[model samples]
Target: MSDTAPADWDPRSPKVLDNQIQAYDEMRHRCPVAYSDYLLWSLFRHEDVMRALTDHETFSNGASRHLSIPNAMDPPEHTPYRRIVEKYFTQEHIDEFEPVCRANTEALFDDLPPEGDIEVMSALAQPFAVRNQCAFMGWPDSLREPLRQWIGKNHRATRAGDRQAMSKIALEFDGYISEQLILRREAGEEAPPDATTRLLHEKVEGRWLSDEEIVSIIRNWTVGELGTIAASVGILIHYLAAHPELQEALRQGHENLPEAIDEILRIHAPLISNRRITTRAVTIGGREIPAGERLSVIWASANRDEDVFGDPDEFQPQRNRDNNLLYGAGLHVCPGAPLARLELQVFMETLLAKVRHIELSPDTTPERAQFPASGFASLPVRVQRG
Candidate 1:
C-alpha cells in the first residue's frame, strides 16, 4: 500500500484474516513476489522459496530475518551455532523423548471426557507439546505455564508489531532462561544432559556459548517446537477427523503415517511467515532487488504453488515425492525436524491407538490461530475412546 511497491506488485488485501489459507493461495497465484510497505518483499512461488533458502550468500540469515535462530543467520557464522544446537536434538535424544512425549499426550488425553465436547487445543495438543518441550529442556514446572503464555503472546505481539509488549515478554523469558543457565552451571551439569546442556556446553568459533547466546538458542527451540507442534497436532487431527478414510488408514496401520504427517504439514504450516533479508543485489521473479531490504518467505503459499504441486490445495500424502519444503530447506531447515517428526508420529499413533473414532462436534468449527501461528487454536471434537 506504500510507494515502495513494485509496479507489478499487488498488495495483499487489507481484509485478509490470519486464519484463512485461501488468502495465501490467491497471493501465490496473483502476486508470488509481492511487496508490502511494512513486511517488505514476500516470495510465494515454490522456486522462489527454494532459491532464497539455498542462496545463502545473497540472502543472509545473520540479518536474523530480524527474527531469530539459525533461521536468521548466514553460513559460516550460522554454522557454529547450528552445529551445537543440532547435537542437542540428535536421533538418540529424540528417541529418548518418545516415552516422555507419549506420557504427556496420554496424560492429557486421559482427562478428556469419554462422550462430551472439549477444546482439544487447550486440553491436549498445545499443553502436551509445551510440557514435553519443557521436559526436554529440563525447565522447572514453575516455568511451564508462563512459558506457554509467553510463547502465545510473543507470536501475537510480533506479528502485530507491538514491540512494547513483545519486548516485555521476551525480556522476561530471557531472564528466565538466564536463571536456568546459572542454575545448570552451579550444579556442574547441563540441565540433565538434554538440549539445554548440549547447547550450553558446545563450542562456537572455538569458544563456549555465552549465557545470553545460550538463552537465545533455547528461546528459538522452545517456540519452534512448542507452538508449531501444538498447532500441527490440532490441524492434523481436524483434517483426519474430517476425512474418515485417512483416519481409518492411520488407525488400521494400513497406510503411511509419516507421509500423511508430511502432507498435512505441507498443507497447513503453522507459522504465517519467516522473515529474511537481502544481503546483496539479486534478480528474482523478473525483478532486481537491492540489499538490506527485508523479505518474508511465505511457507504457506509456497506449499500451495500449483506449479510445484498438483492439486496443491488438496492433501495427498504422496505429493511432491522427493522434494517438499515443509520442514524448510537447506541448512536453515529446522534442526529439531527429527524431534518434530517423532512427536508428530507419536501423536498420531498414540491418538489412533487410544481413540477408535474422531468426529467433529456439530455446529462447531475448528478455528485457526490468528496472527503468527496459522493453524488451529482450538478444535472441538468428540472421540470414541478405546
Candidate 2:
C-alpha cells in the first residue's frame, strides 16, 4: 500500500459545488493533481487528462463495482460490447432519428409561451431530452415522467455516497428497462422494430446477450442520453442568452450551429468528470499515485486548460474544435456522440428558426447544479416569437 497523502482539496465542499466550473479552473492551476476523500485523485489539466484517456491500460475504466456494459470494462471484454453499442449510434441510425428528434423539439417549442418568461429546464431542456430518448428507444410516453424522477434520485444517491441508495436506484432503473425487454419478448415476431427490440437480439462473443447485460447496456445509454443531453441544452441556451451577438449570429445562419454548440459545451461542460482506476503506480502532473487508486478526469477543467485553449472562455469554434474533449476521447469515448450532435443541432436550428430572441429572465436568477451534475438547475428565460 502507498502512503496516504494529505488531502489536497474537498470536492464535495459547498463552495466548490456552488460554482464547479470556476472551482475546477482554480484547481487546474493550483493543484492539477489533487487528492480528496471523495475522489481519490482528480486530474485537472488538459495534458494530464489526455494522458489518462489515451493510455487506457495504465488508467483503466473498470472502476465501477456494478456491471456497466462496456463503459466500465477494459479491452477484450469491452471490444465486442462496444461494437454492439456503436451500431445503435451510426450515421444511418442518426439520419433516421433526425426527423423524430426534430418533431420532439418542435412539439416542446410549440408548448412554450409565445413571448414570455419560462423555466428552460422544466419547460424545455428536460422534456426534450426525455422525449427524444423515449422516441429513440421506442419506449412509451409514460416512461418520461418516471425517467425524469429517476435521474433526480440517481444524482442524489451519488452525491450522498450512499451505496445502498445507489444500488436501490440502479435496481429501480433496471426494472423499468427489464419491463421493456419483457414486452418485446412477449410480442416475439409482432414486436415493434426499434432500438430496444434490436438489443434483445444482439449477440456478443457468439451468444445472445443476457437480460442483465442488455439492461446494463440500455441503462448506460439512457443515463447518458437523459442527463448529459439535458444539461447540455441548458448550458447551450444559457450561453447564448448571455451573448446576444453570438445568439443573433447563430440565428442569422452566419455560424455553424453544430460547431458553435460543441464549442459552447466545451466552455461549460455538461458532464463534469468520469472515473478511472490506476492499474499500476503512475506519476502524472508530477504527482505520484499508486496502483488501485481511483482517479477522476475533470472534463470541465481539462477542456478549459489555458495551455490547450488560451482564454478558455473565448468563442472560437473553428480554432478550438480539434482539441475540444466535449464527447471525450480514446477507447471509451462516447458512442452516442453522433446522435447527440444530431439532436442538439436539430434543437438549436428549430429554436433559432422559431424564436426571434432568447434572453435571461430579468427578475430571476439561474441556479447552478451541484457536483455529480453540471449545467443550470433552473434557467428562466424570455423568448420572442420569430
Candidate 3:
C-alpha cells in the first residue's frame, strides 16, 4: 500500500489485539474492507473473503518475497506442486499414518497425571503437534524438541514484527529442512520412503524441483501444520472442558468427533489469517483498493460472520459443514486437510478413550494467543482418568 494512504484502524492496537475475535467481529460489521499500516487491506466479512479466495486473478497468492511452494503460487505454477502435496495427504497415506499418530498421542497422554490439573498447551497440544509433524515427515525423534522450541522463537519474532529476527528464524528452519534433504540424497535408495524423500524426485513442468523449492515446501508444511494443529488441540480441549454436557455426549459415542471438531474449530479458528497481493485495482465491500497493495483474508472473522452462520457461536456442525472454511476452498485449499483431520480425530479418540473427563480449572482461564495465532497460549484444564 502507498505510504500516504489513510489508516482506517490499527490491527496491532491494544483494543484489537487484546481480544482478536471480538475485535474482528466489530471490524466485519463496522468496516469490512479495512486498511491499516500493519495489514494493508484486510477483508473481515465472509463475502469479501470468499471473493478474494475464489478470484485468484484479482487477489494473487504470489505475495511473499521468498519462495513458499504452492501456498504462494497462483494457477499453473501452483497446480503441479499442489498435486505433489495432495498425494502425501491422500486417504491411503492418512490411513497408513493413523496408528502412528495414535501411538504418539497415547505416549504424550501417558506422561500426564491420571486425575489432576494439566496445562493443555504444553503438556498436550504443542508436544503432540511437534511430534506428529516429525512423524509425518519421517523426521527423527531428535527434531521434536528443537522444532518445538523453534516454533516458540518464530512466534515471538512474528508478534514482535522483527524483520531481521524473522529472517534469521526462517533461515534456521530452512537449515533443519535442508539437512534432512542432504541426508536423504546421501542415502540414495536407502533413504526412508517418507514425504521428504518423495519430494526429492517430484517433477513440475518437466523439471526436477530445486533443493531450495523442496525446502520451501517442507517449511510451509512444518510451520503451518504444527502451529494450527497445536491451536486446534487447545481449542478442542478447552471447548470440551467448558461445555461438559456436549463433551460427555461425544465421549459416550464419538461418532460425532469429526463433526464436533470441525464445528468447534470453526467457532474458534486455529489459523487466523493468510495473505495476498492484489494483481490489479479492485473494489471490495464498497472500498476501492489500488493495485500492488497487500491483502489479508481474515479467516477467523469470515468463518464466524453472523450473516452466513446465523449465530456465530452456535455449535451446529451438520448445519455449518457445507460452508465451513476450516480447510478453505477453491484452487488454493489446504492439501493436507485429509492428514490434519485424521490426526485430530485420532488424537481426540485416544484422549476420550483414556480419560474419563475434561474440565477447565475453576480458578484459571486459558490465556488467549495474540494476533497471528489463534487459540490458547496457555490452557489449564483438569483431566480425570478415574
lDDT of 3 by residue, 1-386 (tens): 56887888998899887889899999998899988888888999889999999999999999887899989999888888998888888888999999999999999888888798999999999999999999999999899988998888998888888889999999999999999999999999999999889999999889999999999999899988899999999999988888988888888894488999999999999998999999899989999888998989999999999999999999999999999999998898998899899999988888888889989998787799987888989999988984
Q: Which tens-of-lDDT digit does each residue in 1-386 have in candidate 2?
A: 34467889999998899999999999998999999888889999999999999999999999998999999999989999999999999999999999999999999999887899999999999999999999999999999999999998999899999999999999999999999999999999999999999998999889999999999999999998899999999999999899999999988889988999999999999999999999999999998899999999999999999998999999999999999999999999999999999999999999899999999999999999988999999999999988
How many angstroms is residue 200 displaced in model 1 relative to the true structure, after the best TM-score fit?
A: 3.1
Kindly give the stretch of ten consecutive residues in candidate 3 with the minimal lDDT sum. Answer: 247-256
Between candidates 1 and 2, the one scoring higher on TM-score is 2
Cα error of candidate 2 at position 287, Å: 0.8
Candidate 1 clashing pairs, residues 3+ apart or interchain: 61-72, 61-73, 62-73, 62-74, 64-67
* Residue 382 lDDT in candidate 2: 95
| Residue-wise C-alpha lDDT for candidate 1, range 1-386, written one tens digit per residue | 23565544333344456445777788777777877665678898989999988888888666552346565677776777787778777888888888998888788778777766778888878787778888888888888788878888887787677878877888888988888877877878424775675666677778887776777778888888888888888888888878898899888888888998988778877666777778778889976678787788888888878888878857677757456777888878888889888888988888898888888988688776765677887789888888
Model 2: worst 10 consecutive residues (lDDT sum) = 1-10
lDDT-better candidate, 2 vs 3? 2
Candidate 3 TM-score over all chains jointly: 0.98
Total clashing pairs for each candidate: 5, 0, 0
Candidate 1 global TM-score? 0.93
The residue pairs in collision within model 2 are none
